[model samples]
Target: MHLLIITREWPGYVLGGISHHICNLYNEVVDKGHEITVITGTCPQSSHELTGKKPPANEVHTVQFGYRKGYYVLFPIALRNYLQSFDFDPFDACITHTGVPFELPLPTVSKRHDCYEATKEYIRNGLSFLETIGDRLMGPFRTIVDRRSIAAADCLIYNSAVCRAGWESAYNITTPSIVSHNGIDTSVFYPDSGYNKEDYILFVGGSERKGLSHVISFARQTKEDVIIVGPDEVNSPHVDALGRLSSDELRQVYTNAAVTIHPAGWEAFGNVILESVACGTPVVATKNCGAVEVLPSSACVVTSEIERGVMKAKNLNSEDCIKAASKQTWDKPAQDMIDIVRSITNPEC
Candidate 1:
C-alpha cells in the first residue's frame, strides 16, 4: 500500500512523544513493504545533529513554519493548498497524526495523540494569570480547528483509552474510533548491564504539564539526587538539569536510576514509562495517566505519595518490569493500523 502521512512532527526533529511514535510507525510500516510519503514542517538542523539519524519517510515534503501562535491558523491553509497541487498518482490511503488539514478525502484516518480540551485545562491550571488570559483569548480558534479536524476524518485513532474517552465526553463526539496505544522500540531502550546503577531519581519532560514543579518539590523532600532531563533547565539545588540527552544517553540514564517518576496529571500515552521499564528500571507514575493502562498495579502510585511510591517500585522485580514493556511494541500497533486501512480500502475482505 502507498501511504500518505501528514504530521507536524517527525524523527530527527522530534517535538514530543508523537514525533517518536510516528517515526517508529513509519519504520515498521515501511519494513512491511508499504511506501510512505510524508508531508511535515521543516525539521531543525540541531535536532538532526542531536539524534544522528536520517528522516524515515520514503518521500518527504517539508514546509517552513514558525512556532508562534498564529502558525496553527496558517499551517493548515498552506498544507491544504500544497496537497491540492499534487499531480502524481493518488495515494491508497491517508493517515494523519495530531493536526489534520481541512477537506481531505475519505478513508483518511486522523490519529489523536492527545486530548486538546484536556491539554487546555492543564494550561489553565498550570499557567500564570497573564498566560491564562492569553490562552483564553486563543481558545475559540483552537477549538474550531480541533473540532473541524476530528469531524473531517473517516475514522479516528487514539493513543490511549483515557484520551479517547476524555475527548468524547468533552466534545460530545460520536465518531467511530479505535484505541491503539503507542509503543516503544525495545531494542534501543533495553537495559544495559555495563552502566552502573545510580542513586538518583530521574524525571523526563520539561513542560509544566509534565509536572516539573512536582518533580522539583519531590526533589526537595528527598535526600537522594534528582536528575531532570528536558529542553529547559531548572536552577534548584535538589535538581540536576540535563537538557535533552540523546536516545543512547537517555537509555543509560533510565537503566541506572533508582526510580523514574512521571507526575504528569494527564498524558495521551506515557512513552517514558515504557522506556524506563524497558531499561529494567521501576517507575512511579500518576494513577490517572495512560501508562496505568499498560502498567501493573505494583508500578503505579498516586501523585501525592510519589516518594512512597518510589520505595514500593524499587522492590518490583526487574523481570516483571521488562515483561510488562515487552507486550507493547510498534509491530502489533502497526499491524492493527494496516488492518484498519484494509477494512476501509477493501471492505469485502
Candidate 2:
C-alpha cells in the first residue's frame, strides 16, 4: 500500500511527542512492506535523531518552512520551489498527525495527538493580559483549520480515548475514532541500557498542558532532586533543567530514572510513561490519559494517590515492568493503522 503521512514536526525537527510518533511510525510502516511518503517541516537537528543515519527513506519529503515564536517564517524560496516540484497522485490513504495542514486523495485519517480543549485550560487558568490578546487574535484561524482538519478526514484516530471524547464534545462530530496508543522502542530503552540512573525524579513535558508548574511545586515542597526535560524551563530551585534531550539521550534518561513523574491534568496519551516503562522504570502519572489503560498493575502510581502510588512504584519489579511494556510495539500499532486504511480505502478489498 502507498501511504502519505503528514506531520507538523519530524525527527530532526522535533517539537513534541508527535514528532517521535511520526518518525517511528513512518519508519516502521515503511519497513513493513508499505510505501510511505512523509511531509514535515525542515528545522535544525533535534537532540532526538542520532548523528549519522542514512538519509530519509525514498518517499519522505521535507517542507522547509515552519512557525517560530508567534509567526510563520518561510525558509528559502527555493525550498518552496522544491516543495512545488513534487506531484502527489491518489494514494491508498493518508494518515496525518495532529496540527498539520496536508490534503490527500482517497480515505484520509487524522491522528489527534493531544486535546486542544485541555490546553485551553492552560490559557483560561491564567494567561497574562498580553498572552490572552495574542491568542484571541489567532483564535479564529486556528478554530477554522482545526474543524476542517478533523471533518475533512475520512477517519480520525486518537492516541487516547480522552482526546477522542474531547473532540466529540467540542465539535459534536461523531467520526470514527480508534484508540491507537503511542509506543516506545524497547530495543533502545531497557533496564540494561547504559544510563546513569540519578537519584532525582524525572519529568518530561513537551507542551504547557503537561502541567510543568504543578510538577515544580511538588518538587519544591518535597525538595527532591528533580530533572525536568523540555523546551521551556520554568525557573525553580527544585528543577534541574535539561532543556531538551536528543532521542538517544532521552532513552538513557528513562533507563536511569528512579521514578518518572507525570502530573498532566488532561493528556491524550502519555508517551513518556511508556518510554519509562520500556526502560524498566516506574511512572507516577495522573489517571486521566488514555495510556493509563495500558499500565501494568504495579508500574503506575496515580498522582491523586501520591503516597501509596510512590510506594507501589518503588515496589514494582523492573523485569515485570519491561515485560508489560513490550506489548505495544511500533509494528502492532502500524499494522492496526494499516488495517484502518485498508478498510476505509477499499472496503471490498
Q: TM-score of every model?
A: 0.90, 0.83
Alpha-carbon shift of residue 156 in model 1 (angstroms): 0.7
lDDT (Cα, tens digit) per residue for candidate 2, span 71-110: 2223323233664656667467777774533344457888
| RMSD per model, one decimal | 2.5, 4.0
Model 2: which ten-residue window has the lowest total lDDT?
A: 69-78
Residues 1-349 of candidate 1: C-alpha lDDT, one tens digit per residue: 9888877766655555566777678789888888888877643431443254433566778665556344455567667767677744658888888566375764788888887688777667767899889888877887788788878887888888888877887786766789888888898999886777788899999876777788889899989799998955696888999898878899999999988999887777888888998998888887657767877865545455788888887787777888888988888889878988988888899
Mark the regions of model 1 whose C-alpha exceeds 4 Å error after superposition: 12-14, 43-56, 66-68, 124-132, 298-304
Which whole-number lDDT from 0 to 100 does residue 141 have in model 2? 63
Q: For model 2, how many clashes?
A: 4
Question: Any residue pairs clashing in model 1, and if so which?
Answer: none
